[model samples]
Target: MLEKVTGLSDLKEILHDKEDEEIVFTNGCFDILHVGHVRYLQEAKAKGDLLVVGINSDESVRQLKGKKRPIVPEMERAEMLAALEMIDYVIIFTELTAKNIISELKPDIYVKGGDYKVNELPEAEVVAEYEGRIELVKEVRGASTTNIVAEISKRY
Candidate 1:
């Protein structure tokens, strides 16, 4: 049922039809797709009728995160996140942040992992413009892509 990774424009159109439903937006690199990512997505979904995950494009990942980052490619990362039942749609954005997408969709709720301060987020202002509230889900400490990479390096 429309389960696949899509572009921002297409997602905006699709979301237009479901304007009445509460849309929750969250953005991340999700390079390794760890437990923390899964839990965060699940919690985000719980906050609204639909969960839209904005994944940083490969180029954007390299820009936001550094080289040697995003061990998994953007398409693969988006595909993995879209596979999760908790995520209603996966939008691969080219920007370092999902501010443009947020401005266009103006989701009812914006969720982030506990690591971030709501007011500190650059998108906070965009969300605020639409009166959207930001929610932080409890993070699974020590369960990060960096930690996974470190462990892999230690093993091999």
Candidate 2:
């Protein structure tokens, strides 16, 4: 079962073995599940023993993706992510970024897809302070939600 943990208060107990496990953390909109998201998450799981995905809350998605985005609701998105075998836990964030959560979670490693340089990431500093590392996963071309949404709109 994929456990839903919204804040750090519940994570410590849930991830009781985090100190021993490689606890990999990553955050994103994940408004719609897709092949790329699956592949990226699968790869991320391989890098650690436990994979925790932080999904953007509906409000955060609206802020990052604009008002007409997040076709899927927060609960639906969380359920879909939880359905994935690679994902151990799903946390929802309502902020523009997961800096505060990262500080609280203090994951061993943080993963982000695409060509985001370590310095360019907002949470990089905090992760660095905790001696945590951030890795960038290769992005699959023609597999982005934005592109898919655009194509669907064009077809209809």
Q: What is the C-alpha lDDT of each candidate?
A: 0.90, 0.87
Candidate 1 C-alpha error for residue 103, in Å: 0.5
Candidate 1 wrongly placed segments (more than 4 Å): none
Q: List the pairs of residues colliding in candidate 1.
A: none
Q: Quick one: best TM-score, which candidate?
A: 1
lDDT of 2: 0.87
lDDT tens digits, residues 1-156, model 2?
Answer: 435544566876777756778999999999878999999999899889999999898998998999998999988898899889898888888889989889888889999987678888999999999999898888887888898899999999
Best-fitting candidate, scored by lDDT: 1
TM per candidate comes to 0.96, 0.94
TM-score, candidate 2, is 0.94
- Residue-level lDDT of model 1, residues 54-135, one tens digit each, is 9998999898879998799988888888888888898888988889989998999999999999878999999999899999
Lowest summed-lDDT stretch of 10 residues in model 2? 1-10
